[model samples]
Target: MKILYAKDFNRVLDFLTINLDGVTLAFSTAENDRSFNRHKDYGINNLNSIVKDFNINNIKYLNQIHSDEVLVYRNDFENITDKEGDALITSEKECAIGVFTADCVPIIIVDDKNKVIAAIHSGWKGTYNSIVTRTLEKMIDEFNIDIVNTKIFIGPHIRQCCYEVSEDLKEKFIDKTNIDRDILFKGRNLSLEECILKDVREFGIKEDNIYSLDLCTHCEEDIKLFSYRKSVGTYGRLFSFAFIK
Candidate 1:
């Protein structure tokens, strides 16, 4: 795996791309790049140019309603612009998929053997609804991907140290998933990463194949990544993209 940083439109961005079995899979973070924001139309245009620099064509994005919905991208699927979903999966090499997040988790899954890649946006609602597990299940049922061989990358998000949630929300995760309350909650705070990891492991993804950046968006003040909790209003979003070349 190689980490690289570049300037896009005068804004610095960091990308993590890995070459495995002759396929290049990558995800990126917006480092002090406020222009990469996804909420504004200009921000989306800026993101398109940044993705273009990666030599990716026809990048697919979602309306991202924070639901458990996952879209299986196919060449025949039309209206990519209006698609509303939180996750996207595709085996087509011509199509690259990405998700936007500020403090929410951005997950990328790759099946190198099958050349299938998926991009997931998992917020608290999506996580509580088992979005990652659902996406993996879709890959298995539709694409026949080997869960054990699939590589999962959990990108930068708000970590447990700064991801404090309400007691009701913490209880919801514990009671709903049957995960240990002690494991999910620490002093009235919930660990979203741990919750997602627990579900992924339960789905039979190998421990070693699962990797996490473990960088907290809220804590990394010097990194200049956007954080909704840090600044509720006027905060930007970080884009995590993945595709097979």
Candidate 2:
């Protein structure tokens, strides 16, 4: 669970292989987008081109709805009619999987031995709905993943420094999660990273195994990381993905 900056994108493969023998996970920044069609960039043609870079046999994806729903990826999960979920998972070898997010948290979990991986898109709504918790539960139930042995990584997004909220939202989060209301601020600022970390821990992931990128997209506009709050109507998006080798 190493937090590598985009400066080291060239070394991404190296890091993935060194960290785990059978799997790899990564989060892309705005730099990956050439034309920058945030919604359509991850379309079929684009996904196919991206898949060629890796030796993965198949790539599973989700129509993320920013809800607490966690969908397991198997023939059955794929065959379902209405495709709507916030997370995706796969145990197939060389099976790459992905989930897209702009400023929302990208939650990744990998089981080195079982060769299972999961990717989750957790926005503030998804966070309050406990999407991370549901994703972990789905992993444990569907794949029998060992919570203790699994590795989890939370990618960069809106940090509290820039994620100011209204009092209504703050109180709602506190009531829903029952987190220490003190963590919410007088200015109604909340740390999405901290909230995700707390949820990951509550899901039985160890503190040491949970790594996070404190990069605040709003604060670092120069990096071109998308910030819904910062960019308003001009914001673009990034994708975070994980796969079993």
**Candidate closest to the true structure, highest lDDT:** 1
Off by over 4 Å in 1: 1-13
Q: What's every prediction's RMSD, in angstroms?
A: 3.8, 3.2
lDDT of 1 by residue, 1-245 (tens): 21123221123246556567645555555553645556689787877776567676677778899899998988888776478999999888756688889899999888898888899999999999999999999999899998768988887798888888887887778888887788877777777888788888899988888877667888875455678898876677778877677
Residues forming the 10-long window of minimal summed lDDT in candidate 2: 10-19
lDDT of 2: 0.70
Once fitted onto the true fold, the runs of candidate 2 whose alpha carbons sit more than 4 angstroms away are: 1-19, 35-43, 75-82
Encode model 2's per-residue lDDT on 139-220: one tens digit a residue: 8888999888888878768877777788889888877777677675436778776677777887888777877665676777
The Cα error of candidate 2 at residue 19, in Å, is: 4.3
Backbone clash pairs for candidate 2 read: 57-94
Least well predicted 10-residue stretch by lDDT in candidate 1: 1-10
